[model samples]
Target: MHFLPHHLADLAALAQMALAFLALCLVGRFVGGRQAQFEIDALAGWGLLAALLTLWGVATTLSLRIPAAAFLAAALVAVIWPGRRPDRAAWGELGRLVVLVLPILAIMATILPSQSDIFMNLMPNAAYLVDHGTFPTAGAPDAHSFLPVAPYNTQLVPFLGSLVIGGFQAGGLALFTICLYLMAALLFARMLVTPIDGADARPETRPGWAATGFGILLVTLLNPGFVPRVAFAGYGEAPVAITLLFAGWLACRAMVAMTAGETGRTSLVQLALVLVALVNVKQQAIGMLIAFALAAILVAGYERQIGWRRAALAFGAAALPAMALYLVWRVFVLTRFPDGELKPLPFDEWNWGNLAPIFVSMGKVVVEKITFFACVAVLFVFLERRLRHRQLDATGKALGLAAATFLLYNGFLVVTYIGHFPGVMSVEAHSFFRYNTHLALLIEFALVVTIRNRLTPWLASCPSLARQAGVAAIVLALLVPVGFAKRLRFDFDQPQPVVRQLALQLAPELKDDDRVALLLPGDTNSVDWMLMSLLHFSAPRRPGLDVKPWDHADQAAFDEAAAEGYGLAFLSCTKGNSLGLPDHASALLRHGADGWEPVKVWPYPPVDPKQRWQPALAPGPLCRS
Candidate 1:
């Protein structure tokens, strides 16, 4: 009967793989379009499905034979399947897409705890919600009740985790992330179509759509702060970025439809929903809101058309509830603090006056942080423009506006972050880079659209050798760096300091309600926070006792605990472990009569705490010291 559990697990894993594949298929169908979209979608669908099935087979509790068969079959199919065709131009486009997705995929794949470990943190919330018949407003307090002031409640991300956990799968975040990437890619490709209708300077070509999509991927991936975020940590920004880009496409479509004879209400409604959802994803999306609204207004003014009023209304209708939700959260939920201050910096901590300084910092950001693919986007913009006429289109203008808006937004962000960045750099630096990447995605999307009209003719006009060389260059540019970066960062591959090891070692000897303090001696503060959060396995009332340098009371509390003979002690054993504990505590685990017994220790190296997280460019590292 217990073996049946293994069989059932195998079945469940298979089903999850099938589900992921089906989702990819649907995405390809919706986003890819008629020509390469279908083929590409089908290939992606099958590849992901195969990968999923292989993973399931490998993980199943079934005898190794089942997994062996699954992996062998998948490998066989992949080998036999048509490899990427040798069309250099098409391959070049595909290369760009891969480059764009790498950072997002890397972060999504890594950054979080292991699937088994994540369940330890996420399941309690889900079970509580299911038991209560609703999602709770806060984290659990006592074993049986909610906390009065839950500091680290998993409200938003946990719900998504819960949905996946309910089904006993580890891929919800991955699937959601993948879908967002696919959605943005689709929207970007569709926008590529809209500007192709005219004999304007840029003419439609086979490479056009690919170039456009590739461009979007490049700018978004290479965004100023994106690399740190992806290479290091994920902040649920990728989906939001994808959503906003999709919203831009929808808005672009609605505008063009209005320009043409189609003023259907459905399109307007869809447009509105996208806009509203964009607003809900994050408050900083306001920059986008203003940009899109202004773009709409500008389009209206340029055309002398009054009908855009209805379109704008539809967009507002979709957006209003989200806007209101944000206000409700801000005014009531988030802002109900002492003196009405939100406490956490709202819309990030940057303002307008520090643009010059921000730009000054760009040399480091661009050189050390920016990816090669992103640089290609800027190059492509120049190349595409030179190849065609000198003028920009509506898409170009809108993109220009979006880019300018982003710069303005960053200027504001720099001002706010100025106070924080007094010494080295502020945490807000990462946030600014992350937020600005959104605008970069928008600009990249617009550039792609403008150039989409002219790509085919350029390819047709060029010698096959030239086209092949260009394509080879792009492929080399994208693939080589990806290989190097993956090796350098190893985001998904790096194992976190074993929290379970620490937990198991510490938990067994201690009586219940034992208060344990976690202090990082040489690591960044974020690491301490992460470790404390992970320490929740004990169901502690206030698990993470961060012992900062200035807290004498905290030291006194440890002194009191030592005098009282606390049951067990867990010390951060890393070299930089500075707990204000004497050197004897480090060596002997006890100070004459003051320091507690060191029953267990976990070796968490002091990671650089102040690293940036730019989801658009890269990921930040997990700082769990």
Candidate 2:
């Protein structure tokens, strides 16, 4: 009877959401009295409020019996109280946006495979940590520590995974991935609503406001650059993007408060933490921090908040903790390379001239990524006129800050990487192009919104120019999505046949407590899918399934394989055969003619002749010395 009611309740809740959104929009239009701006705001605000309330209601009903009921109840009370006032439209609007955006974002993340090998390595590490209450050594044969400060690299993510794996039970790779996905979306949402002094142009215009807010959100969400690297063969840009969005939001807010002669300690502290996290996660964001600092100086100068003594103290207070954490992490964890050795580059190589490629790469990354090359040309003329008239608002100013920071930081990277960039260009070595792509998307959104607002005034004065600019902005904005549509689709739907085939082939053979060695893609280090399936099949205590290195080979590698006790093996032919797995592996070898014999081969789909599969020519009975 309890189960029956629960299922019925679930269906009823979903039906309510569908009906509620429709009602909210109609109610918004009726109350707004045909004012586009008011209707837009009402639609977004009321829509959000309704959605949040609905979810809260359902969650309360579903989760009331749980121990954390008190906490949930308190949270709902606070959320409801804020919207009780007449001027709580923003709260409602945000709530509506949250409901509409968050679910879609979560779906996108859930559907995507965990494109991070780091997640796989972290889950197992978390398990070991739970049992031993200590960080494991990277040198330990069985331990899969991707970073030296194992606990830190494996931060909040693993605990989230522990929920599914049952208190650090063997594998929670999917759980960790889901946490990261949600965290990124949540951070993005928080950043969007966070007020920036310069970004709220024509705050009265609801469509404009909606466009700006949704634009920024889309910049973070829809940009192909946010997609995880393993799927795109990229890095953890999602984490970095989330970090930057949070940092940028805090920085913009601080600038706003400073402009109004108000100092926000919380914003200052947040900015500092974000900077620290940026450097900790991806060191290149250091350039972004430096550029933003310069922009802050510009903003302060423009607003006349240039009290050197006060500014210095405020910055020092915010920055000290991040710096301390960075110093500690660098000294303890980040210093050790995968080989367990620390290698530092020479001082001469770190200079501005050598760093030019980094900046260029960064610039190229932002521009090329959001298809800024196309949009800039379309929106530039109108923005130029708006700047001439001095109609640009706080949003414009913040955007300018972001754009300048991107160019400067990206330029710094370009100079640093370019001297050697020519040599490494072909190999795509340390390019830093992907991060730049995200920066570009951020810049483009700001530029488009600024241009969109500026053009309306010009429609009266220089109607001809206004018409051209309007047409261009709309066309470019439309095209921007098209440019990125391929990448997004790829992320959403591209077939990972190599990985799928490997997992499917190994699925039937898998049983409770059976360890399996699934091959990684050659030229890449992704492993979550294979590892997740293993967890799915064997829980609590699965046998040792070793994922052998496909990079450098040594005796220790062989020793690790022998320790795992894997009796069966499957390899991804695409993940090259020559790296770590030896020709005389106990279970299987690379093109060997020994005691081994072929069992089964499941090639990737499309079975095209060109779609090659390496035949596992094992040693048959006739083979002898």
Candidate 3:
């Protein structure tokens, strides 16, 4: 009976994720056109997220049912419509890849919610949304109630998932979002291996292209940060990063078409939708959006395909909706919650001394994660250009745009780190590494394309045995670093049985009308908080019971709680330490050289005495009214 709720919850969440995936695929087909399988996958993921954000905004402002109905209608139309289908060969290839990837996806989905960020803010905000159907106001009384008013559009996906799956199991949302990253990676792989327009029509080049693309895909998949690690961490960076990749991919396609003197209307519209979604996901993506716009204009001017007027109009048409949405959200926040505005760090606090260390650390990360493949690709392109005595082609032009964006985005990061300046450049300096993943991926994509374009002809001329050997060598070379990095960084250990037992024992002690104060240590792990929240969720009196951290509580607050007969519990306490509690409370808990004695705590429904152990809590002055 105890295990049933967990099973039902997982099943429900899985069902909801499937429905979302189907709806997204349909929407992607409707908006982006039926292109390659990988293209369709990328488009579907992008469209789904964009639609979800727009509907969520409307739902939060108007009514939740409206968005629900709208989504159902869209999904209905997408399902009933006769969409283009991929050929047998394409399906066969996709199936093979799926077989290879599914186990990793399953493991990732199962363990994702255990990530630390869920407790810090993600799960709490999601729980608030599930209970209230909207963001909490600044006036609400609770721990971290001020979070809702902050710039956190990233929470919407998990909130939406919680609505469908029940409450605050953001692991489900993370699993669904991972689809976007997988699709984007697959799309990059497909583009590299497959022949794009303007490719040499020579039949001999096909096999070499296939081999090269496969090798690149293998290397990319093996990257530690690419798969299960960052993908399932439930970081807001996942959506923003994937969206930027999609935007870059679309922009590349558009530039390629324009270079051939044709306007790629479908690609351009898709690009616009992606950019809008990017900004909504993370405010920092505004920089990338602007950089993309500049790249679009510059490419147009250089190629003279659509001319300056049409180019400007096209770029504006793509960016305006996103800009408008951002403006509206900004206005709403400022007007509704003026006091919730974030203050910039003082410029005087900026540590210029940290610059050298910051650069060195960032450079090392880049070299470890990105530099090798990027440099090789560039060198491949250079050698090809030199040997062939040819000018830059369409792929080369797109590469230029990607390279420029990469540089511009990194430059922005440098300025940002200097300005924000988190003190002491240790692993904390690497905190921003997640933000850089997208740019690094983009650079890799551009390089892969350029290398494919230049090397396919040369590779086609080589003997079959030599080509096979070369591909094997590249894969081995890439795997060396991946072996060292060992992609699994997260703690996969399940929560201890003692924690669960303690939570169950305390549930009956809680009353519907009572408020419970949880006094957590200053250095408490997020997992501890997550377990505590789970305990509260499972309590018999959960509906009216209020469980909160009392880190801000004073002596008077404790005295009042005791007078009112409220429940209080301390987690993992020891002698001589109050864990950030006030001095008066500290003395009570450590009256003797040894710590306070534990007392028996009862389980719900009164279990046998033999099973009961001494409670972690002991009576104290603060608790004696």
Provide the global lDDT of candidate 3 against the true structure.
0.53
Structural similarity to truth (TM-score) of each candidate: 0.59, 0.58, 0.73
lDDT tens readout by residue for model 2, 148-245: 34323223233222222334433233323223333343333333333345332314322223333344345444544444332222234444554455
Give candidate 1 misplaced runs (Cα > 4 Å). Answer: 1-111, 114-161, 164-179, 189-232, 306-318, 331-394, 411-431, 461-513, 537-557, 560-567, 574-595, 601-625
Lowest summed lDDT over 10 consecutive residues: which window, candidate 1?
145-154
Summarize candidate 3's per-residue lDDT along 426-459 as a digit string, tens digits: 2234555576665655555556676677676877
Model 2: per-residue Cα lDDT at residue 228 = 34
Every candidate's lDDT: 0.41, 0.41, 0.53
lDDT by residue (18-77, candidate 1, tens digit) is 344333343333223323332234333332332332233223423323432343344344
Comparison by lDDT, 2 against 3, better one: 3
Clashes of 3: 1
lDDT of model number 2 = 0.41
Q: Choose 1 or 3, whichever is better by TM-score.
A: 3
| Candidate 2 residue 454 C-alpha distance from true site, Å | 2.4
Index of the highest-TM-score prediction? 3
